[model samples]
Target: MHDVTSQAGFASPDLSAFCRLDELGLVAVGQRLEPDRAVLACRVVEPDQWCRRCGCEGVPRDTVTRRLAHEPFGWRPTSLEVIVRRYRCSGCGHVWRQGTSLAAEPRAKLSRRGLRWALEAIVVQHLSVARVAEGLGVAWDTANDAVLAEGRRVLIGDRARFDGVAAIGVDEHVWRHTRRGDKYVTVIIDLTAVRAGTGPARLLDMVAGRSKQAFKTWLADRDEAWRDGIEVVAMDGFTGFKTAAAEELPGAVAVMDPFYADVLVMPMSVVFALLRGLSGAVRSA
Candidate 1:
């Protein structure tokens, strides 16, 4: 068998900079080479194990190897096979396993760094969940669930994300191009950054359906203070949207978006009348 302990010396390759297992109270014991990927075996650095129920020292028995998907190194996928020691409390006679920060929760297959990489791939890199799943070497449903759970915990669940709203925009978007069911959704945006000249607008919420009732219901769900802070609402030429704004945001000014006004406002008769006037002036000149 290949000795992993001998490879930990100075002559061995250093993966500490990228792996950073030390931060999680883990040390890389050895590496197993495979045709497709590399598996790094790790163990907790701390030798002493304590019992959770009673304040007593535990005796180390055997170890259980847990396989976890880790962040990729270069273009190749990497996995961590952690050997966690099982311990028996001398006083309480309780048995427990060693815990490390390598993974987020117990029985989770993805490491902490792997979870971060997956989130960045979806949010910052704009990659699909399937691609992220392939990179993490896991099933599609596993990757999707992990990414969505982490996203909700870190981003969507943030209470401060909705604060300081002064201006907004509402529009409808076609979510799906299918013949079966309703595929339209109402999109709400925070245009406060644009009005303040700070940054581009961001999507605030998306509601199902595209009607005055949908928009009105969304506005009604907001707090009174949030509703009162709206100073302006920009929308297209949809009369239903106008009516909804009038009912919900009576204090705010409703401005027609220039792009939509150009597309929906001018009639063919008005355009021909202006063209005739210009042609007559040119002929007289």
Candidate 2:
């Protein structure tokens, strides 16, 4: 049998690149494929030489194995088993372990790539939570929590997401069916793309309730420049939304959304006639 340490010694550079461990200071020493999953064993490329406190040469004391879920490949869920070596200074008795931040966040179960894949799979590909969980080889709640946390950190928490807003839409949505938590949420959407004929509307934020205070407080968090850029606010029949917009963004034009306005003004006969005309036009096209 070949020594595990020497397995990736002559592995192709392409393979190393595909594994994406060089930047993390890890080299794949072994790989195993199972019927349902794959595992890539990695070791720190550079050994620790000196202690941080005393600047004395250190010796290897022990190693701890860290297993992280990696992005799936070849329809098989993949995992990375990294052997993190701990060093102890004989002079100062100081101890440290190999840094693995490049691979993942501290105490994170999934690698950065794995988290990003799960997020994109759900947001862009519209895959269900159960499907994403199976792809990552994790429990349903695990995948759900990780993906949601990542989304909040990367997308929702970022201040840049609120920029370039010219129009917005607000409505109340049933957030959670369970009685354990808040059942309703105020959903905010960026209608800039929809108004410009560029693409579908993008979700901007979600507040706790449909109350005027909730929406007003959310708007108050933004800077005056961002608030000034808002030209229009479209909402359903809810008067609270209008009140919130009027209070927070007095200059913005508040309009009834097409669906709600049609209901409020146009009779059913006219609505049916319009729908029939649209259908006939579609068939003609």
Candidate 3:
């Protein structure tokens, strides 16, 4: 009998089977590696569920449509054309459009495949979404939506499993550039042992504002276990973040390196080495 790992070797046909193609034509196109190890790529296509009001599948009086690309579940690239049909229910005469899918909302143009590519470029390669979209021959909205969607999706699971968080990093950057008004985003990082790998960083959250109230409310939502595990915080010299961390996570170390800047601005070689060191320390401790 072939060992499971041996059966899953790169050269084996199991790779293709891993990416199961459904009737709707979503295809798994790539694979990503993680240190802890999990399934590589397994893209599957699924049809949209019917509306409760009408009890009709893909039924429509007036058609409205949108498409979106979402982050891969594992190694599979994914995409969906989310359609919302405005239908007058034959039974009740009520007219309404259907709800959006949790995976991709209605009216988006990027496929889940496109989203994964864009995000991988941003997270692993440090390439901006704009550049990734440009290279992929897609629109700016597609790239931006992919980033936002992926960020939310990953954050949900990561937030649930987070524990033993000794240190954290809170920082902000301009998510979208506008020459005129305020367009900043705050990123909260969980520097914990579980995130010490080739997978994505321990992103706690991202919010639009740079306010004390916003950060305070956000910090207050965490459980005592996570809050207590945090021993140190490294952040830019932002008083709002510093204050929130101090107030919410008492007795936690606050490391302010005001001179350092965004992840994009840092050298890749240096960043990877430092991250590896952080990972090692976290794993050991």
Off by over 4 Å in 2: 1-13, 22-25, 46-50, 54-57, 191-202, 256-285
Across 1-285, the per-residue lDDT of candidate 1 in tens digits comes to 887676676355556545877766677888887766778998877765888889799998899998888887764678888888999999999998887654556767788888888877766565666677778878777777776676556644766757999988887765444565667667677778877879766556667788999999999999989999999888887888889989999999999867433322222222222222222121211
Clash count list over all predictions: 0, 0, 13
Q: What is candidate 2's lDDT per residue for 121-194, written digit by digit as tens? A: 76556566677778888877677777767766774687776879998887776545455666667777777877
Indicate the residue-level lDDT of 49 in model 2. Answer: 62
Evaluated against the true structure, the overall lDDT of model 1 is 0.72
What is the full ranking by lDDT, best candidate first?
2, 1, 3
In candidate 3, residue 25 scores what lDDT?
A: 43
Q: For candidate 3, what is the total of clashing residue pairs?
A: 13
Taken over the whole model, the C-alpha lDDT of each candidate is 0.72, 0.74, 0.53
Scored by TM-score, the top model is: 2
Candidate 2: worst 10 consecutive residues by lDDT? Answer: 276-285
